[model samples]
Target: MTAPQCPVAHEVFDQQYMRDPYGTYASLHEKGPVHRIMTPEGFPAWLVTGFEETRDALADRRLVRSIEYAGEDYRTLPLPAEFSTKTVATEDGAEHMRLRKFMNKSFAIKRVRALRKRVVELTDGYIDAMGESGETDLMTAIALPLPITITGDIMGVPDEDRANFQYWTDSMLGINTEVVREAGATMLGFLKRLIDDKRTNPGDDIFSDWIAWTDDDGKHLDDHELIGLGFMVLLGGYDTTVGMIGGGMLALLNDRPKLERLRANPEQIPDAVEELLRLYGTAHTGVRRFATEDMTIGGVDIKKGDVVLCSMGAADRDPARFENPDEVDLDRPNLTHIAFGQGPHYCPGSELGRMEIAIAIETLLRRLPNLELAAPADSVQWREAYLIRAPKAIPIRY
Candidate 1:
């Protein structure tokens, strides 16, 4: 009889980890740079801990990021075939490159820089709204909507459809419930129509650019590919920036001095953004890569088809790379965290995300100098889903 599998890891639930995964991350890293574990939802996975090793493993081509690479037995995992084929996140090798290349032109940092003024204006509006409320749940009221609005703005999603996009993103990023799945269908349909509209009547927005985009080979995005890319971007753009603004707010509020520091020296906020990203940084829960060939990363013997889950949260706290890995230091140098997965999958939207978040925080301080958390930190409700982590509600008083 086969013995029960004892995967080497610190078994953790999503809620517990979501609430405070740090101590667990620290404890797990002690076992080795790479830890084999099961998630709260009973998913078999490995979490990479050391920063360098984590970065290297993310780039390892042998570990294909999709259900298909795991072969027939992977059917036990319950992934739909359409999901396996349609999304760039699930593609590897030439496919990943092809999908990413079509997007590169529209997502350049220059394009992000061009959107700065509009982002600032949106930030101003959110702040204005928050001021009227006097006390507000920063996550929902400001942090959340800023990125959603920005993404809609970039993609040129109609105003009527923007909030529904946020709802779909929340579902996709968190638990894949019926709400998420149904909303996803609606969103996909909408993007397909949007892409068609762009094809017929093109505009300057990134979505329009994507709809008309071609790679080096003169290939364009198919409908399914376009839908997948647009879906991924909405979640990616909204969540990372939302986390940055909301999570960064929490981190800064934890220190009145940090709050005042940014107010006094706005220049410090840029570095503060990096430090915030390092600490409360996101894009944390990402896809599981199945090894295409037997290989070792971070000194672990990864068998062919073994699933490796990349946890930026654990990697960001690697003590070997960052002194007092758990602490957030605005002045830390040579800091590179996996907030965006490194290598080929490095987030294409980093510039726009950072700019929107920084401007939000900067504007928040400027507009509401007297802001403080309305509730204690522990009272904040966090997201419990496996794929992404954030507070469900973050209340603050001005």
Candidate 2:
């Protein structure tokens, strides 16, 4: 006989819940580490909010990303069929290892580290475009465009094709299933064409590097797999960075003392970046996993085939895990946070993303020493999407 789930007396996607989720999550954490909740997608799921529970569950091999391992009811998500077939997030075991290996090679630390100069140049270009501005939406002027342009350039996307790329990326990141499917298919088609171009005109970029990578048997990722990989790189790094940089800047702007501290010590940008991510990282929906077997987490029973959403935001703010969970402590120890995720699906672009973020912070503070929010923090709008949490526009004045 199985134990019944412990449903919380709260809603996950309540309008107030979406606007500011930390306090609500903290309250939920007090009730229990794991709660039975409905996903924003309307699926019944287990939500793990405790720090230890989230870390352990993330590392658990029995809880997988592969939809094939999902229970019959869980498999009925309204996603496109192709979503379950490929992509790093939907794979498990040796197959996931294979895709991860390909990605690891393409985004090797050395390779990403080498891009620092180019990233700086790109960052500077965007700052230059700001032109000592009176006011501008940083989300548009800097935060959003920088990563998209960089990802586009790395993927060998031509300048003329970038607007379409951005459109598809925006559409795909939304909560609407039909919009996501249509945008996904469109992006995949565009990626296929881009990959075809790389086949003939290889260059010094990630796409070209992937084109050159081949496994032992003289085999390489087929066109479909390549398309999946391309989508993974582009989508994975885009909006997440946008939210981090934009929300992160807003966080600092709202807290002038810390902003001054960081400005006084530019070298602290790295630590500040990590702290910001821990506090204000994107991905409110968190990562989803399907249980391959019955499991007990945080003293709660989670049955096999149960869908789990690990709240990275809640985990990072867990009082038991950090000394000052709510405060932005730049001097905090380099404690591992699941902001970039954990285990097999850890973000491949983490280092690159971190570099971009650090550069964004340092560049902004240096170039626009008087930079401040153009509007009240409460008045700024946030995107209401399930997967990504970010402000629609971070209005800033310098």
Candidate 3:
């Protein structure tokens, strides 16, 4: 395909857009499936908002995840050597498959199912500690701690070190460069110690399994791969699940009628969870992919090395793909949303994420029938991250 001159970039990441991204997406969708937009970081990229376009772009092999393919103008955070290893998100083709295959076993359906009882126990325990709640921040009380603890257990992080582990994770996500670098180094050191311990004394955890796993050719993950994979799993499962839980609960609590329906018939909680993900999945955009060659998406000419961001947040709620796209419909006929993304790069931890959200919501509905927002819905604050969509905190009374 022949490439055309890039279109004028649309400015769409301002405060208004962050506050009501769905509204911003709706406006973008009305304009076209794909758009040339200036990211908050002051770089030009294509934002695919149409459901079909986003789905097709996600599965498109020509759009790759590696930073090497990026245009010179594309900017990204600098990582230290210890944190620069190729991970599932950074590799493509066979290497990606190899990494994904190894990680998949840890989150397989049966294994995730086995953790259901434990998830319920943890959820109940956290809520119990809330002391029947007068008013509390749901993010700390349940959303953040639950996933942190669960993913911590999976990584075999000792109970005493979990607080420090959480701190490192939070610091790594902060905006300060020095803090991020320091946190990355500290976290890498901690993970290396944990890996060494697992090697000497294996356990029923993902890290130990990665340490023991050998491919058909008797090849094992090298030190770099092991650390990279461990870091990815630990961070990936924590922030995204926390966002989903907090966002999903906010969606329910905002809608009294639908919330009541689920409470009346707890069996429908799974379906409600799907709808919640469709509307409020934390991954606002798929990982940035650079075009390997000139291509056309939704009629927009994308040149080689141009950065492309498939907006799952926009696509899943596209009115054309979904009827009444803005509202949640638990009985919605088609639940196959691209919130977890699509194709080979689709989220490996999807089953585990679904299980966690379902269990958390179900437990909340059953235990706290009177749960309500402590403040007006509009007063709730949302995190100002371009890649992630979640509330900064959810104040509630039960």
Candidate 4:
């Protein structure tokens, strides 16, 4: 079947597009729900945009999500063997649901609800450790540490070992080739050691819980699955939340009045979290999906094996999904955007994710009311990336 005409100025994978896709997404969304684009590897794919259609398309299964289509190489950047495993994002159907079911109990809203106080403690302590610095990088001082510690807490790692694990986790996700390998090796080894330790002396952490967790027929994550799942949670947890904190902080700083409002009433931080997520969700462009069957969507025809790309970054900013979408309104009503994505593949750590961001914004505002951007907005450097995007570093003086 012939696909609809493409609307982007350049292929979605093009470096220029990566730098800024807001304009392209606006143009494409106006055309319809979807349009064809070239993948980072230059392969043809459909970029879903219309808010309703994007949600519908993600819910529909004509496009399968599985490792079968994920070939050896990543679509954009070069991927090492460490990332080759078919994660929850890359898996499909029953296997996907099965894995997700196993995780649901642990990642449920109720479980995360119980973690609220703890999330605050983590956020507060990280801030306390900052002592008395006239200026500090929020990402390093708070954003990066909160989620890293949270991930470590979930995995049952010792407090002392967290800094080491956090370092390698970043390394693996980093673009540096050598750093990636070193991180992969280090993380794998540490997880193995941690797993061995858990076997003998399991504690009340996610890793220990998972070790004892089982299904109706006694299904459980095997050792290999354990390693993969361990790496997956850390990778997803640390970077995504860290990016959210960094990006969200920048958003809040740009709207200092809004930041002040949230600070005045800490109880309002939850609404502030929703608004921040809607305004500054982090994700460069998410992964690609291949059609397993013919499907017509958003006035476009998608054939079997046709690739589908969903950009959470673009979808969150789609004006149709949000009222006054670009503007940050703490009181925005019915605020729902696909920052953590939609459908069954929605980020499992979302509740925890929200809490982390909420606490980060609240603590920083309360403790460092004088927080001022140390770097010029135009002068601030942005890291070049395709899978994830965040400030290279944010300088702030408080």
Q: Pick the candidate with the highest lDDT.
A: 3
Model 1, which residues run further than 4 Å from truth?
1-10, 40-43, 71-83, 175-180
Per-residue lDDT of model 1, residues 1-398, tens digit only: 22122244335544566677777778667766776676543556666677887888888777788666674334233223334465777787788888887667668878789889988887788777655547878887788888888888888888888878656666655544555567666766777788888888888787777767687788777778887787678778887777778878888887898799899999888878888888887667667778888777776777787778777877888887889988768778887778878878888888887888789889888888788988898788766655666777888888
TM-scores for the candidates = 0.91, 0.94, 0.94, 0.87
* Model 3 lDDT, full chain set: 0.85
Ranking by TM-score: 2, 3, 1, 4
Q: Mark the regions of model 4 whose C-alpha exceeds 4 Å error after superposition.
A: 1-4, 7-11, 30-32, 69-86, 158-186
**TM accuracy, model 1:** 0.91
User: Comparing 2 and 3 by lDDT, which wins?
Assistant: 3
Name the lDDT value of residue 388 in candidate 2: 71
lDDT of each: 0.75, 0.81, 0.85, 0.73
Kindly state the number of residue pairs that clash in model 2.
0
Where is model 3 poorest over a 10-residue stretch in terms of lDDT? 1-10
Tell me the TM-score of model 4. Answer: 0.87
Deviating ranges (above 4 Å) for candidate 3 = 1-10, 81-84, 164-176
> Per-residue lDDT of 1-398 in model 3, one digit per residue for the tens?
32232344444777777777887888887888888877765678998989998999999999998888999889775555545547888889988888888888888889888898999999999999988769999998999888988998888889887887556656666445677778888888888899899999999999999999986668998878888888887767888898899999998899899999999999999888899999999988877899999999988889999999999999999998999999988889967799899998898899999999999999999999789999887788887666776788899999
